[model samples]
Structures are given as structure tokens and as C-alpha cells.
Target: MKYTDTELEKTLNELGKATYAGEVDVVDKVMNRLKEAENKEKFSIQKERKVRWTIGTMSLAAASVALLLFIGNSSSSQAQNENDGMAKFISEIYNRQSQADVVYYTPDYIDILLGIEGMDENI
Candidate 1:
């Protein structure tokens, strides 16, 4: 499209006058809308940050609890193993005590009692 220079000047002059008179209510409405959108964006960003922090804290707490439980179970198993070892040691000691220095006698005791020639003193 082509316009004469005169027509362009006239259109520019009218636009200038309208702007100077503050007759551009659409611009003001657009500015207000932009400000509101910026405020809402800021609020949403802050809300997202808070939610992320809460989730992070909860995850850390859960991890700590899990670690504690793992430690407790490991310690309990170790203690049980020690108790089992002690019980085995005690049983071995009891068995040794019961078998100490007991003499057996058969009809062979009569030969030793009479001091026979083939009697062995080792018994």
C-alpha cells in the first residue's frame, strides 16, 4: 500500500494528539494486566520454592530414620552371634568336665586284685 506524504503526516499528527490527550485506555489496561501477571508469577515462584524445601526436608528425615533402623538391626544381629558363640563355649566346657578321669571296671579287675603275672599297672 502507498500513501501520500501529506496523508501520512496527518495520520501521525492525529495519533500524537490522541496519545497526548491520554485517550489510550487500552494501553493503561494492558499495563495493569502486565503488573498483575508479574505479581502472580512472583507468588507462584515463592510457593514452588516452599513446597520444594518441605519435600527435601521430608526426604532427609526419611533417610535418617532408615539409616537408624539399619544400624539397629545390624547391632542386634551381632549381639545374637556373640551370644551363640558363648553358649557353644559353655557347652564344650561342660562336656570336658563330665568326661574327666573316670575309671572303668570289668571282670579284669579280679586279675589285678590277685596280683597275677600278666597284670598291667597302666590301668
Candidate 2:
């Protein structure tokens, strides 16, 4: 299928003088196809960008929700810990109340209990 130099020169000279008068709309057809392909390419690129943006936004929202849930759980656990401590404190108060005969010693009673004889004279 290789052309000799003389054949190549003759083909080029013919192409230079040739006109598409018999196929009047060939140029328009080619241009229309090119335009359609360009539009499809542009739409494809735009659609791809939209998909990427949507995925990114959704991922950010999901991460934000996860972070909020984690913070809420930690705060709830801290509150539960405080509530447990408060319940223990309340139980201790009830136990103290139930010991009705528990005596509080003044300084003199402490000295008597400790067998210190000169505490009265010191007072």
C-alpha cells in the first residue's frame, strides 16, 4: 500500500484542487459530529465533578456525626460516673443517720477517754 513519490505528489495536487460540490453537507456533518462529541465530553466531566463533591460532602457529614456521637457518649459516661458517686454519698448519709447512738466527743471527753487527769485544770 506504499505510494511512490510521483503518486504521492499527484494525490496531493488533486486534493488541493478538489471540491465537495456533490456532497454539499459533508463539512456541516463533520462539524456537527465534532460538536456533539465535545458536548458529551464536557457533560461527562461535569457529572464526574458533581459525584466527587457529593461523596466528599457526605463523608464530611458522616465524620461530623460520628464525632458528635463519640463526644455525647463520653459526656454521658462522665455523668453516669458522677451519679454513681452521688448515690454512694447518699447511702453513706443514710448509714450515718441510722447510727442513732453515735457520740461526738468534746475536748474534755477526749481527755477523759485518753486517761489524762490534768485536762480539767488546764481548761
Candidate 3:
């Protein structure tokens, strides 16, 4: 399996010489073995290619689903944020109206009395 190029070339050269010297049977056997090896290699390569293609397609589908889910979740969160903003705005307006009503209805004498009481307490 680990033969160098030089060693392989030497072996092929020896086989060629043997075939030329009337060793027909040996040449036939060697050729048959080479053909079998080539057929086996071709089958193995095809099997590997099929497995790789299946894995690649499945990975692509998974990635696409993940991307879609991420986008959907992001849009949902954005919508929730917009709703939260609207709720906060409405709450602030209600608070401001309540405060204005309190200030308008409260008498000046009550305010003066409260301020004096607060000053006395601080002192």
C-alpha cells in the first residue's frame, strides 16, 4: 500500500518483461487482478460520494430551518417591544392626567398648611 513511485514503476517494468518473454498466464492473472481492483475502487468512490451528498443535503435543510426560526423569533420579539412601548406611553399619560387633576382640585389653603407642616417637621 505504501510503495514508492520508483518501486511501482520497477514492478510494472518487470511484469512487462515477463509478459514479453512468453509468460502469458502470469500476464493474464495480473491484468484480471488489476481490473478487479479498479472496479472495487470505483464502487467505493461512488458509495462515498452518495453518503457525502446525503449528509450535505440534510445539513443544508437543518440550517435553513434554523435560520427561519431565528428570523421568526426576532420578528416576534420586535412586535412585543413595540407593544411594550405603547403600554408605557399610555401609562405615562394616565399618570400625568391624574397629577394634573390633583393639582387643580386641591385648595390653596390646604397646600399652604401642608407646606408649613413639612417645614416644621424638617426643622
Candidate 4:
């Protein structure tokens, strides 16, 4: 309902001044909530730092392991590739139809055979 300012003031005066109904520590409650929020924020920040450190450490370890595996496998594969190239070259040279007879044993091969037979030691 609409009322003039003077009528409103007269009504309020008849109602008397308002009084608080109960004991309420609003300031303490607000301060306690602030403290709890700050503590929660600090805890979350520390947890975030821990998670970052853990992820960083794990990533470094994974990279290190990958590097070691690559280096190790590369050296072994290089040796294998060299051996394969030499074998392919020898097969091409010695096992051809035009050069089958030229694939006969050499003196070094005969010596190795004699040593395997225990005859080179006697000689």
C-alpha cells in the first residue's frame, strides 16, 4: 500500500524501535568461515604443487628410459646391419651361377677346420 512520508513515519513510531530477537555472533561466524576458506585454498595450492612435481619427475624418467632404449637398440641394430650387408655381399659374389666353383674353401678356412678337428695342434 502507498502511504505519504508523514503517515509512514507516524506508523513506524507507533510500532516502536525494532530489537534483535536472539544472540548471534555474526562477526565471529564470518571470520571463522574466512579462516576455513583460506586454509582450504592453501591446502589446494600445496596439493597442486605436489601433483606438478610428481608429473614432472615421471616425465623425466620416461624420457630417460626412452633415450636409453633408443641408444642401446641403435648400436645393436647398426652392428646387425653391417653384418647383414657383409653377408649379402658375400652371397652375391660367391653363390652366383657363374661363380659357384669359385666358392671353394681357402687356406684359412682349411686351417680353421683342421683346428676344429684337433689336427692343427698336432701339425
* Candidate that would win on TM-score: 4
Which pairs in model 4 have colliding backbones? none
Among these predictions, the greatest lDDT belongs to 2
When summed lDDT is taken over every stretch of 10 residues in candidate 2, the lowest stretch is: 101-110
Cα TM-score per model: 0.56, 0.52, 0.58, 0.58
lDDT of 1 by residue, 1-123 (tens): 899999999999998887464545688889999999999999999999999999999999999999999999999999999989878865755555466533442335434443553656554
Q: Candidate 4's residue-wise lDDT over 46-97, tens digit each? A: 9999999999999999999999999999999999999998788666544453
- Candidate 4: regions farther than 4 A off: 1-21, 96-123
Candidate 3 residue pairs in clash (backbone atoms < 3 Å): none
lDDT of candidates 1 onward, in order:
0.77, 0.82, 0.79, 0.79
lDDT of 2 at 48: 99
Model 4 lowest lDDT segment of ten: 94-103
lDDT per residue for candidate 2 within 13-91, as digits (tens), equals 9999988677465898899999999999999999999999999999999999999999999999999999998788657
Q: Is candidate 1 or candidate 3 better by TM-score?
A: 3
lDDT of 4 at 44: 100
Candidate 3 has what TM-score? 0.58
Whole-model alpha-carbon lDDT for candidate 2: 0.82
lDDT, candidate 2, at 106: 46
lDDT of 3 at 79: 97
